[model samples]
Target chain A: MTARTPDSARDIPEATVARLPVYLRALTSFAEEGTTTCSSEELAVSAGVNSAKLRKDLSYLGSYGTRGVGYDVEYLRYQIAREIGVTHDWPVVIVGIGNLGHALANYSGFRSRGFRVVALLDADPTRKDEVVAGLDVRSFEDIESIVAEHAVSIGVIATPAIAAQAVADRMVANGITSILNFAPTVLSVPDGVGVRKVDLSIELQILAYHEQRKSIAPASEDAS
Target chain B: MTARTPDSARDIPEATVARLPVYLRALTSFAEEGTTTCSSEELAVSAGVNSAKLRKDLSYLGSYGTRGVGYDVEYLRYQIAREIGVTHDWPVVIVGIGNLGHALANYSGFRSRGFRVVALLDADPTRKDEVVAGLDVRSFEDIESIVAEHAVSIGVIATPAIAAQAVADRMVANGITSILNFAPTVLSVPDGVGVRKVDLSIELQILAYHEQRKSIAPASEDAS
Candidate 1:
């Protein structure tokens, strides 16, 4: 799925890079639906962003659109995927085969996109030999050997908050530099290591903020 | 847990609001460590942001810091929590008692923060008698009754992608205004209904992007 070469790869903003995969996903959907071309406005609606911002994001990848014909869906999809390095599948390790780890292992989205779960490790001895999503759960002590075998650079931490930092330390010691942390605790990592946390409660709290506003506004307006 | 009143609540940016929970969590951690006060730099390092950005974000909530005294950790924590409306517990409903739903129901972070799971519903009849995270798994048909009983405004969709839209439609029809979708699909809802997607694959893809860059840069530089 790799492209010839990426012309404007280095200077993309972090925010824009974060949104490129989203644009790529939207474009892939359009291609699957038999759409050949789409204007920025149409793609923006599908990507859930405004057309102007979409144009700015796309421009960072290089000029791929026709003057009036808009973008070729398949071409744009490949470009963004290549830009995001999803063109080549990356082997990953998941530590802590708990409920969240089980869900992540069974997640079809990862394989469909660009990630391959090469190993599933758990600290519990009972989980050893258990099969999940076609992979056998191994002892957490096998992390170094498994990471060396697969040459995995990215790791997922689904362990408890208390165990998260310890697992992260082990992963980093074994040369894993990129981590996707699901634990609620904040991890302290050395420089050049990338950590992105996905907290389920944080998302709900943000929604609660808006929901509270909707409930309070009417009453306050009436009183005023 | 509520505060006196929130100043400049209406003018806070969505980005800042989203980060408030992160900041609040960091402050709570500091308070737990017996720390009574912290400078913006210390808090920013703990929160994984720059000190200047953290200061600007805190400024939007209110003037809570002194010039040289730094911020009172407990006071700032409560103010941010109140501003984000997490001081009041929010009743929530979970649809799909599958592996993901089971994990979410058992997730202690939700209860410790602001969310309370009132009901767990699934479409499968076999799962009705099952109990997860101490809550009985009810039938999906009970959605309306459960929602009405709990007055739940927020819903979680842990169903498969094929069933996500139908579940969302039913949720919206039953008066759910905000949704946290874990399903790997884009949901279409009526205007004014908020949808926040937490895609496990998207986060992995972002990390892969940076990981890819690190792997490629040295090779390219050597070639040049």
Candidate 2:
């Protein structure tokens, strides 16, 4: 097997890494509309980013648009997908089969975007044997075995705030290294473990702050 | 009423605005744990931000901790909450009562964090009158009346991608100016309206990208 380049993975900025998926999605849309090639300006508009930033981001992947011909959509799309490591399926185990958990398990986007829900787990024994998203809810104790069985590295925490830390700790001990926490509380994880928190309330609170500003300063409302 | 400072709202950067809610949550935790005051270092660790950055963010609100005494916990909490505009309830309407919508409706965080869900709306007529979070699932057509009745300025869209843009357009026309979009689509809103998108898949993809990097470059794994 050929060795992958190590520097390529290390050189991309986190901000650019975050936007790669967005650019991948935009390319998918362009391809769907039967567009084979797109200028940086066109792709930027589709991705809701400016052209210069888009070009700079793509430069990290060593992709440069031709002087006049622009980028080839399919090639750039595959490059981004490979760079994001989503070209192949990544087995994910989700804990906490609550309402939000159910929504996440049922979300078709995860499966379509190269994440496979290998297991559904909950701390409560009463939830066992319950089927969600075509998978049986297993005991949280099964995390170790499931992670070992699937070689899962990414785990989702949809548990309540009180249980989130314990759940995260358990996931870490069992070799999971990445987390997408939907819990409202902050999680303290060890070094090398990546954590991304998604709080719906926080998102709304930000909007309310902006909305309040808009009403208070109508003259600056158009600034956004 | 006395005129408020016109420049305060515009001066705080967007990144600072997003972190204010997080800081508010951290302070709330400290209060619950019987801590009356906290140093910048302590609060920064709780909020998962660096102390210097946290101090700079708080400076925008005209708050500076006493050199040796640190900051009064309750005072800082209130300041952050007020700055985030969550001291008073903001009536919000959520559209699209699907699995994600059901989860959003049942989320206790929204109600506890100064947001009142005035209505749960869905386009499907079959779901009308179904109870979610103790509120009846109203028709999407009722958005206009509900916004008028509650004076709602924020709307949440948990609809499918195909239905999101239309829902956003309808919301904007009805005087709703801010949106928290959960759909997996990009929305184009007119100037003066604000939109914040929360895509579970995008967040996961970001984690996946990082996780891939960790495995590929074990030497750089601790960069996070």
Candidate 3:
């Protein structure tokens, strides 16, 4: 059998990678509440996933809980965090100081979860020199300089859909390999670059689908 | 075999339900481009899914593309929209007129996709009487009246994490059953209420996972 090494962690599935943060968040909460251990069932409920899936996902990280004891909350938390590379903070830049950008800059979750907002850049000249989250909103052209300065690998696009592609183009050109897109458009990036979108409307649309189903089905049956 | 009814559409898998909106968006773009018909390959590329997966997802909606001529874009679009219940508009109330809230209010994708933000509410008295997205920002206490007035069953929570749970509580008590949360906290909603979250930091963390993997692996071998 091949020896399990840190490199093997890279082989985890994309779906599991996405869910790792959720599991990490749940573990963080458990840690805060002074919980030392949790079974797959308990953690699954907290993560809003099934127990079997939770166990399988944890196994991807080589975290197998004992038969009677269950997972060590703090140990599993550190394991997942290390696997996700969040043990060391990742510096990031947010382009487009619009409402969404402003909210993102002020978001405390990023700071608590190993992400540092190094800079906020906006294309609009009027927005330049404005301060958000204690950082001055600079011109978008400064992205290249700021990114190089902070060695930022992640970039956020909160601009309008019309400007999303341009912003992404700039981000990729400046060596930002991972993007968190808030714009309502699909971004075409290079092979090495990663783009993950958080569309507010799409989330609402999904909820609407379930809400519609609830209206049609009997109220006694929980669609969830 | 049982006769397929409209209610049967509710049985679509959660994964398929998530992709239906994406397919619909792709079809909308095709319609905009004046393309009346598209093969599975073309639609799959537009939706950023594999052709086989696209075909399988469309099959869930009982949409079988023409043997040779491909699928009718408009027909497929309407069918998916009907299946997702976006043809009928959903009136939504947005609580918390902060930066993210402001961005959400002005998001045009919502109006086009099916959600109507009827009222923008904030707890801060200073924010009251402010105009955003052509609607006056109202007091949070007006949630009951505004929800009732619009018959809104959906609510969007863009508040700070500290206030997200409280906002969700108020939304549920005021008769909002479906919530699209942009806050960075886990919301504890009672059974029967559907809550979908769009966490920006979580998305970034997921990307960071992949980015970390790519760094460990050689560039010659694609980690994706």
Every candidate's DockQ is 0.69, 0.84, 0.66
Assess every candidate by TM-score: 0.90, 0.94, 0.88
Model 1 CA deviation exceeding 4 Å by range: A1-8, A218-224, B1-10, B218-224
What is the docking quality class of candidate 1? medium
Query: Which pairs, if any, clash in model 2?
Result: none
Model 2 spans with C-alpha error above 4 angstroms: A1-7, A218-224, B1-10, B218-224
Ranking by TM-score: 2, 1, 3
lDDT digits (tens) for residues A1-224 of candidate 1: 36645564456789898888889888988998999999999999988889999999888889989998899999989989998999889999999999899988988788889989999999999999999999999999999999999999999999999899999999999999999999987898987799999999999988988887776664544533
RMSD of each: 4.4, 3.6, 3.2
- Taking chain A of model 3 alone, its TM-score versus the true chain A equals 0.91
Q: Top TM-score: which candidate number?
A: 2
Docking class of 3: medium
Instruction: Judge candidate 1 at residue B202 and give its lDDT.
Output: 86
Residue ranges of candidate 3 with Cα displaced over 4 Å: A1-10, A34-42, A50-52, A63-72, A218-224, B1-10, B218-224
Q: Native contacts recovered, in order, as a fraction for each?
A: 0.77, 0.93, 0.74
Compute the lDDT of residue B84 as modeled in candidate 3: 87
Q: What residue pairs are clashing in model 1?
A: none
lDDT of 3 by residue, A125-222 (tens): 99888999999999998988999999999998989888999999989999999999888777889887999887776787789889988877755664
Residues B50-140 of candidate 3: C-alpha lDDT, one tens digit per residue: 9999888877778457988899999999988988889988999998988778878987889999988899999999999899999999999
TM-score of 2: 0.94
